[model samples]
Target: MSAVPDLNTAPTLDDFESLFVNNRDLDNVRAHLSKFNPIKTMRMARMEIRHSAILAWLLNPQETHGLGDKFLKAFISEALRGHPTAMHPSALQVSQADMMDTEVRREWRHIDILLLSPANKWIFVIENKFDSGQHTNQLARYLKLVQSSFSKDDFSHIRGIFLSLWDEDPDDDRYAPINYGSICEILEQQAVSGRHPLTAEVETFVKHYLEIIREATGMSEEQKELEKLARQLYRDHRRVLDFVIEHGKATDFSFACDSVFGEGLEHGNIVEVDNERFVFNNCDASSISFLPQSWHKALGGGKLYWNGCENWAMGFPITMWISLTVDADGTSGKIRLMSEVGPASDHEFRHDLINGIQNATKTNSRLRIKFQAGAADEGRKYSKIFKKNFFNVEDVQDQERIAELIKKALKDFRPEIDAIADILPKFASYGKFGKSGE
Candidate 1:
């Protein structure tokens, strides 16, 4: 059957003047696009294009899902049009088969598309997704896989390619897409409203990339297919719009959410909501608790005892950077002393025994600290963690109370030596580096 008719779609650079890379009126731009039949605007399916583009355009680059990613994948393949090198040829293969289902194991490395260039001794393997970074490694991996499938003789002449359209690891070979329709007009709006750094970078990149993408706009089969898809999407959305205006809201909004969900989850309780989300309604949280101790005495601590020095130390892996955050709001900051133990005396802080723990108790309290000496590669490193992450924050008034308690506790802590001039009062000596204490 013949495809639905698309809007004339003869886009010119002038048509998208306002939507140019850095021009910022994004909301109006998107509103303008919403008026167009989306399928006809991008020349693709309405259901397929608009919804996916919305997500890919709104969220973190690594988080786009479903058809948005599929369209992105298709769009990237379209880039090979004007691009040429000692690698891929101008004409290439699309979604060509890599693995014939062995009458069994179905979807493995179902690579989105592959462009094999006999002339330039290259092969391009592509995997696309709507918005996020999940497929970051796919290009290199799929390229390697495709190359490995060939006999060693083919390896010498074959080079593989992996292309992704959205923001991926900065190292990926990305190019600015020179869009030409209502889609083109919307790119600037999409970037601005979304505040996308990578998309904003397009302003800098697009001017330079014009020649490359102009050729790509019309060259290969992938571009043609994409153009066809874009047209179909535009036509469909237009029909939807007409229907909506006449009848108010179509019968379908979250139309295929269920089918999409079923494709992702297999067993009980795993519901496919979106690419990055899941609803686990059946999970049992009651039986979960900490591991019991000294099932160890039964196991008779041999290798396992020293193997876990947790008894002798606060055992847990820590990052190279240690953070100590403090919060002193107003009404709620007093030490609920552990073991009826109040704050420490000067002797404890002076002796440097658990000074870190003591310093942490102070709201926004800074410290000049020395580790047990052998703590780091060069003795010790000083670093700071923001308050929200590190400290036990209390209301600002409570903080004063906590401090008052510490002062009361310090009255009892007497170190063997009182003449040591290097140790200063905690807050009095607080400085950036431990140097402030002295």
Candidate 2:
């Protein structure tokens, strides 16, 4: 009943069936076309970074992706043992439309997914963490809300899940943990089984998404073969591909951030303060700014507990730096007026600096700052403010706003930095016996 394509304009019926539709092998044309699938290449792959997207897909049972109730049941089963067998497929009556509304409360907190059933007296909270670390006991706070909202009987029925890229234990013992690998397995099983009859379109989409997950998990033989072919193709046409790639937009957020920060700050009166670390003196060489690698080394050295902060001032009793804190989604960033006293510093200096800053921050209520004396190698003590999210990268106004926030934070902290710089000399002169005012 379908009209045949004209040979000149489109592939003939025989060619289409043989080379494109029915072909299971990775042909050059298929490989090239696969790159253009936004779901496979961008949206699905990006779910590894964007937790909300993954939560939405998984929480929705009626999405007709043919994995109905399967992902949710598996996730719930993994997160909670002794869960009601009523969570099975036949007993599941999840309305994808209502599930999001019941789960997500935007004004209070941006929870990834929430599911509630009054009849069953059940509550499930899923907090999805792809790449970003928790900042301020986010899981604990969310659990508190859940407890307060429900009765003691209902509270007993609650299950908290921390969904991550890998099997990570939650900071809170209350939360059970699961990972993307489980979700990948669910999709793979659904694809293989004929139990769920899906439309051809849905099947193709699921396969594409599954491929992305497999690639991310390093389990994709298809990906390996395609990559090998790509390398050979690039070797044969290196110059042409290189030119095209050089002019293309960056696929990685860190690369874009590096390019923007490096180019924008290079014109300033900068000096290499730490040549080994590639830290630079910025703002007429008063404050210390980090080159991209230095920034990564400083912040990405360990598990990122706070937001990402990249630059700071140098030559103080405590390490004071200006840092840009980007959110998990890479949508926006805030400037952090951050400082820390590390164990590497002299014990006398550390004690003196911590004591002085603690006193100063208390009296200076104008800035509304707090002091946290953290463990040496653990979290960094910071006074972060002016939290803003910039979406439009091309907007000069957004860029200027970030610059202004950085300038304000520096201006506010200048007096403390000067005091620290002043004390460093006195402390050096008096040796380890230096008093606070000395």
Candidate 3:
């Protein structure tokens, strides 16, 4: 093996070129990653909801998988291990109980998976998360909802399991933290030991699921080997890799947002307010929002209303959004320039905002604002002001096309945008009205 280069030295173009030439480790890593994984191929590998569904199928004793209650028992045993004293005594008893009559429920009361066995007086409230973290006191709320629904006298052993890809401490101590590694261990044992023999088809499916979980949790032998090779390669070409990573163009949704809106701002297409430039808030990698600075002042910033540009909407009472909605196949979708009123905590303010837009349309005529029937109702949170599909699905692949389409939409809606901007300042003084939490 060649001696590792000094990482302190700055990497040149020659160093970068060396990485692409005669790099066996890099080739091996690529080949390893190219190996077929059915879960990944179907695009169900990283989806948390799908993972929960698959787990529910496996955990149900009456399910067609034919593993009986073996998987369920093993799952419970693994969750309870090393933390018996911290858990309820009845819950500890559940590990030894017959789970053949267990009923698995997914998304029950918004919980990921709920397992109920009336025969054994046991209930398992499982909250599964693959990539995301628990938010809004969801763990506590789920446990509370389950307890209220299932009476303590009937279901004496109610346990909470926080199953995640990584070790995450649940907001509620009642939830026992369990990683996907435990799940892989259970599945591997069943597949190899043949304690409860599954049919050929069933066994194959289980093994496929096992492979996905192993890869996700970094438990697969192939993944471990890849990591080893990757580390070695990094050591060999540390300076070059560091330089590339530092100067690399981001290949995420945020990059798309930057390309479209950033260029629009530069080209004088997106309007600037009071010298405050439009800022893009990336709501995860799926969606992004660039709200005008005036909207920030009108909606009392993020503290009073919604935090971040959630659901592609910019401010609370009223705002516009340039949205990209992808289809199920993940390729084709439309880019829409849309605006909405309301969906705010302040109902009175929401109604006023909607009324102002509707009245503006009558005077200006060019505003072209229209409201659906019952939009002014106090109970209604969201009312569409206007929407225009500016870009087709085919235009999404080209960055230049996206920018051009956005500019055209901005030019077309300039009058309406200006009118809305004028009306927004009036609501700035509007105090918090009605109940919170829209």
For candidate 1, lDDT tens digit of each residue in 378-424?
22232221222222423222323334443232222112011111222
| TM-score rank order | 3, 2, 1
Candidate 1 TM-score, C-alpha based: 0.23
**Candidate 2 vs 3: which has more TM-score:** 3
Per-residue lDDT of model 3, residues 47-113, tens digit only: 7777888999989999998888888888877887776445563434656778899898888877889
Which pairs clash (backbone N, Cα, C closer than 3 Å) in model 2? Answer: 311-322, 312-321, 312-322
Report the number of clashing residue pairs per model: 44, 3, 1
Best by lDDT: 3
Residue-wise lDDT of candidate 2 within 1-438, one digit each (tens)?
A: 865433334333454344335444436637655576546444445443344564456556666565655556655665555423333222123322123223432224566777765555667777877766765798898878887988967535666778777778788766777777877776666655566777887777667666666777667786787788777755544444454555553423323334333544542233332232233444321123433222323332222222122222332223445545555555445556555543323444445545554555455544333444243223333332222211222212144555555555555555554444433433343122212322
Error of 3 at 330 (Å): 18
Q: Pick the candidate with the highest TM-score.
A: 3
Worst 10 residues of 1 by lDDT: 283-292
TM-score of 3: 0.56
Ranking by lDDT: 3, 2, 1
Better of 1 and 2 by lDDT: 2
Q: Whole-model lDDT, candidate 2?
A: 0.50
Q: How many backbone clashes can be found in candidate 3?
A: 1
Q: Candidate 2: misplaced stretches above 4 Å?
A: 1-33, 40-44, 47-51, 62-68, 81-108, 153-155, 227-438
